[model samples]
Target: MTLIYAMPGNELFAELLMQHTGYGRAGLSVHSFPDGETRVTVDTPLKGEQAVLVCSLDRPDPKLWPLAVAASTLRELGARRVILVAAYLAYMRQDARFHPGEAISAKLLGEWLDNHFDALVTVDPHLHRYHSLNQIYSRDARLVHAAGALAAWIASHVERPLLVGPDDESRQWVEAIANLLCAPSVIARKERHGDREVTIHLPELGRWLDHTPVLLDDIIASGQTMLQTLRSVCAYTTPKPVCAAVHGVFAEGALDALRGEGVGDIATTNSIATETAHIDISMQVAEALTAVCNIITERRWG
Candidate 1:
């Protein structure tokens, strides 16, 4: 069973779930009171069935009370099992303590959500150094990378190109794409200050400069790093690079910032829908859900 809440920015996701699981297996609705409190009503029954809740924990909605309440209620509604699909998990940047008395928000969030679901799944969680979310959840958490979908999208349109990793954190994603395309790649470094300022350091591209550069990053919050890197590479390289990311948080005027920076093209996965999200990550997410469902099914009957 699939329980869907009518959250903004999740219509495409809900539709994808329906496409993958068939219409009759899903339920969706939302209820709000006059005093501002909200409630989620699963329009169809979920009793005795494994229920998967599809929600993207994006900005403004990440701390939404109704979603949490809905999650807890699903298990109580006779759902034999509950799984959460946080398409774009927020508060993940604060995974570790960087200051005195500061909360490790990711750890707290992960632990708080641990007991609510039999499994947790997300697409391209903004984990800086961590590749797998199991390290954070310490249980049944799946971090689904959008690489295959991203690669397929690129292959359909892009020609032979050089893949560039925007920073050390993006090496895994960049290398994976490079391997998929059998193309050359390189990694760069950046010093970020707040959400709007960044200084990018690009390494010697050598012969790779002849090929078009496709800069890839996991997230683009303020678009500063991408803009700065694009300018730096354009100034020094022969053929300029296009830019893409898994999540286009694109806070504030980030998209305009990219345009003003003279980026020829920009693409990001639909983890957060934007005019620039030229690619979608749903197929990758569907594959992940299939794997988790299989595991949960096997473990239950094994």
Candidate 2:
């Protein structure tokens, strides 16, 4: 039997997984001390069952220790195996040291996960520098693309959407979503000066002026890239632009900031929980988990 256990913030997502997988309910208790230390307790017997641990590593600092302890505790409690299903994998942005004495966080965190969990399953991770998760994670690390879920949401709502990509890096998935929706797409040029400072050079959108402009990016952390792109597109089209992203890590007041700049609609996958997270990626993740479970059952760990 597969049993699903959720870390503190991941309970709702785990419940969805349980519904799809028809997996039995299991629990994990988290207690934080006055000294900023964490205590993790597995609440049920996990002997000989595939223990699926749900912990979306968004704000990962506070949750890391609990996750580590929980995984270890599950193993100690006689779980046959431990699999991590993170809706959003964190610490993937920094793959190298750009300056002196900078830590390669992606590499380090990947190694840490390998040491703690037997397998990993997560939605789209930032892979600009690294080609694949295999480059970093040696275990059964799987990628569940959020494009299908994003496309599904778009198809249901907007009748006409001119898909807009923030950069060349976003081309692959944005194009996939566009194809699924059978919509015309364009790529914008982005020049990033700093974290919040970005300029987007949009192509002449006069031809597609009638269609609703949908700006799609893998992440919208600061929301600056989409903000600039929306403003540029607004110059040509009268229709209010729609912002679509996989992970809505709206840093600070990025959501309100985007709304302030006249974004008509904002939709993001539930990779990171937000009021803007209207698009649900749990079905996609559940499907991926079924495949992962099959592999684990077959003892395929490469």
Candidate 3:
């Protein structure tokens, strides 16, 4: 098996995966023409061997065409199997149409990926209504959680940490981390008026006043929820709360806004490459890939 990274500036993750899988690394070179056309080249031999493409779909729009071309090109080059390790799978929130004539983007993207790759693996995708990836994808799709990694990081870093969920949607993640650390947890009631405006009602935590509040969520897209929760919590507490997420999809000025709101610290897993990516979830992803590889090997031999 060989691993090929789709984009540049991802050598660190590729190196970690190489160490985990004991697989040789392949290169993919991309160039853009004056007419805004992209040309992708496979720089290594992959004939008759399994090839895995490591690409995180954070800012996925620009990378989609190149990725599609690369995947198809690999097959044309005689690669036996192609697997996609998308650390942060995008377009997962639009599982259903909110209005008439609206396209189900999640299902559409899944169909596109299914036609390209033999198998897929991702970490903590933004699944709202869809129960499983199999519901949307036809191929072998695996979802890996980064809760254990995030929980361990919280256990070592924060003192007297009180796990907090910005809204009911975040209860599962907050509770899981709280259980791992044997700490108290709280959930805030959220009412969204718009994309940028949200009202958060934090529960009374006078009993756990001594504990430092750490707001936990799966994904932070606009930072509105975190900001509102921070303001609500700080109104009664003196200690500035820490904000943590599994996927930090911090939009423009989102992180800065959080810091401006008196958030003590910010951290997230390396699912999406960002400056606040302090926790490494590569081991967890590599373990999932190892399981997939084992299953493939078994089927081939059995």
Q: TM-score of each candidate?
A: 0.89, 0.96, 0.96
What are the Cα lDDT values of the candidates?
0.76, 0.88, 0.86
Model 3 lDDT, residue 155, Cα:
84
- Per residue, candidate 1 scores C-alpha lDDT tens digits across 105-198 of 8887778677676787788787775556776787677778888877877677667678888788888899998898888888889898866677
TM-score of 1: 0.89
lDDT of 3 by residue, 1-302 (tens): 65556565556777787788787888888899999999999865556777788888887899889889988988898887788889899999888998899999999999999899988989988788998898888888778888888888888889999988999989889988888889999999999998899999988989888788999999899999999999888877777799999999998989999999888889999888899999998888888887776677677779
Candidate rank order under TM-score: 3, 2, 1
> Which model is ahead, 1 or 3, in terms of lDDT?
3
Q: Which stretches of candidate 1 lie over 4 Å from their true place?
A: 1-6, 23-25, 31-36, 60-63, 129-131, 238-240
Give the Cα error of residue 173 in candidate 1, in Å: 1.1
Error of 2 at 24 (Å): 1.1
Root-mean-square deviation per candidate: 2.4, 1.8, 1.3
Clashes per candidate, residues 3 or more apart or on different chains: 0, 0, 0
